[model samples]
Target: MEFRYLGNSGLKISEITFGNWLTHGSQVENDVAARCVRAALDAGISTFDTADVYANTAAETVLGEALKGERRQSLEIFTKVFGPTGPKGHNDVGLSRKHILESIDGSLTRLQTDYVDLYQAHRYDFQTPLEETMQAFADVVRQGKALYIGVSEWTAEQLRNGHALAKALGFQLISNQPQYSMLWRVIEAEVVPASEELGVSQIVWSPMAQGVLSGKYLPGRPAPEGSRATDEKGGANTIKRWLADEVLSGVQLLKPIADEAGLTMPQLAIAWVLQNKNVASAIMGASRPEQVAGNVAAAGVVLEPGIMNQIDAAIGSLAERDPAQTKSPASREA
Candidate 1:
């Protein structure tokens, strides 16, 4: 696997890293999760991403249990804060100082690790003061509980303000995780440019558009069985957006280009995201081990400039359809 610097930081993460979002704590059992992690490790993917809210905190516990003894030191683990993980208490959520402090201890205990390679704010918390959040993050780094810190789903202005706060307070804001894919070119707006200017690398999630770019779904067809589209936890929004007529048509338009490039739809989809200089890695989420292997193989299939141009042309069509909904990659770029 190819390794890239996370922003300007010395931390090097795999181009194809495994992530435990919904799979680890929910779909897969303990032994299965362990096998998936081992599959990633064996494939030379050293980074594993998780979040406190994933699977109601069971994701971290399973991840910690999988990285036993010597394996712990050899891997890079990342987890996020600022999501609800509770039996219904208001204090159990958000990026407040109390939540950050309480969450980190729980995460550390569950993962059984002394320090996380990177700790990220799951999203911008409107309720919490950015400075207060930054200060707490800095303290975590100073205390050695987390080596690096990042943010996810932040706006361009928020990223700038956060970076300034980190610099003034002597903390490093290294990266941002965001949803980026061929079909969802929203990050190209302000998020990409801002992240580029500030030296924050983008570790994009959902590069496959949550399987829309995987080529399994076709227009006017029933939702595939055993697919996320049919899964209750996959969320209704995904089904509505992905199964929409225009979205499926867009995917259909890209098929010939992928074929010409000698790549599968998902391979072409993932490779397209990596072509951007700002993207450090694409968090490859897989339920089965073979899915992980297939995703890793996509890193090897190079897309020619012509093929890239074809892809750009196809996706550009969507801008005319709904320009107002475009998302800026300012948080993800550079």
Candidate 2:
């Protein structure tokens, strides 16, 4: 696997990061999840990403157990906060200092690790002062709970404010996790520029659009049985926005393009995201071992300029490029 420096940070992560968002702890059996993680390792992937809120925090525990006995220093493990992972309470969510402090401890316990390579704010907490959030992150680094800090789905303004605070406080804010895919280009117009200027690389999630870009969900047909579209445990709901006929049909048109490049549709989609110099890694999730092997093959494959232009022409109009569309909850309401 190819390794790239995460922004300007000294750490290097695999080009394709194994992530467990919807598949681990909830969708797949423990044996299946463990096999997928093993597949990632066999394919030379050393970076794993998860969030405390995934499957109500079970994802972290599963990932931790999956990585047990591996040389910890060889892997770059990342997890997130800023979601409601606990019981209903006022301080149970957001990026408040209290939440950040408490959330890291719970995450460490669940992951069976003392320190995460990168700790991210899953979303901007508008209810809390940016200063409080940044300071709390600095404290996390100071306390050695997290080696670095990041944010996810944050707008250009939010990143700038947070980066400024991080700079003043003498800490590194090295990454942003956004939903980036062949059909989702919201990060292109604004977030990318802001992140590039601020020296923060993007570790993008949903690089396959929840498997839609893989050509498994056909246009003018029922979603394949047991596909993410039929997964009622949040996957179906998350993928509904991309289920429109136009989008699915547009995706279908890319099949020929994939053939021309001697690649699978999913590989083409992943390589497309990595073409952006601002992206440090493309986060991929899988339910099976073969899926992990197939996706990781896209790590070092570079698309020719003409192929890239063809991709843009094929799905350009169908893509979401509106900077305003990149949003976070004003306050994660309970």
Candidate 3:
């Protein structure tokens, strides 16, 4: 697998990071999930991404069990805070000092690791003072619970402010995890430039636009059964916006583009995101073991400028590029 440096840090992770967001502990059986992790490792993936909030913390336990015997030094493990993982108590969420301090220990325990390579705030906590959050992150670094810090779905201004505070506190904010894909370009306008200046790379999630770019969902028809669009657990809700006829019709135009590039629709989609120099890694999750290696093939593949232009034309006016769209919860109440 191809590797790239994460931000300005010397640490490098696999181009395609294995992530378990909606599948692990929720949509798949433990054995199936473990097989997918095995598939990722067999395919040369060394980076694994998860969150404490995923499946109410069961996902981490499953991942920990799946990766029990691997050499820890060889893997780049990441997890997130600022989500209600436990029983949704008053102190269960946000980036408050109490939550940040308490959550990392829980995350470490669940992941079966003493320290995560990078610990990210899942979302911006508008209610908490940014100083409190960054200070807590700095302390986590000093305590060796996490080697680096990052934030997800934060606005450009929020990243700048947080980066400044993290610097003042003596720990670097090296990455930002955002939902990015050929159809979702919100980060390109503002966050990318700000992160570029701040020396932060993007660990983009949903590079397939939650399977919308896979070209399996055709326009003017009902979603195929057993697909994410039909998943009642939560996947259906997250992918519903892209189920519109207009978006689906526009997505259909990419099939020929993928054929010309000698890539599956999903591979083309994943490769499209990695073309950005500021993107350190693109997170890909799979429900089946067989799907892992196919997506990983997109890692080192480079699309020519003409193919890139064709992609833009195919999805023209259907993409979401408004800089105002990259935001987190207005208030993540604990």
Give residue 307's error in model 1 in angstroms: 0.6
**Residue 137 miss distance in model 1 (angstroms):** 0.4
lDDT of 2 at 111: 90
Candidate 1, clashing residue pairs?
A: 186-327, 187-328, 187-329, 190-330, 191-329, 191-330, 191-331, 192-329, 192-330, 278-334
lDDT of 1 by residue, 96-141 (tens): 8888988998899998998999999888887778889999999999
Candidate 1: lDDT of 161? 94
Off by over 4 Å in 3: none
Give candidate 3's error at residue 194 in angstroms. 0.4
Supply the global lDDT for candidate 1.
0.83
Candidate 1 lDDT at 124 equals: 82
**Top-scoring candidate (lDDT):** 3
Query: Candidate 2, which segments miss by more than 4 Å at Cα?
Result: none
Error of 3 at 65 (Å): 0.7
**Model 3 C-alpha lDDT per residue in residues 1-334, reported as the tens digit of each score:** 9999999899999999999776899999999999999999999999999999999999999898999999999999999999896888988999999999999999899889999999999999989999999999999999999999999999999999999998899998999999999889999999999999999999999999999999999988889989999999999998998989899999999999999999999999999999999999999998999999999999999999999999899899999999999999798842
Query: RMSD to native for every prediction?
Result: 3.6, 1.0, 0.9
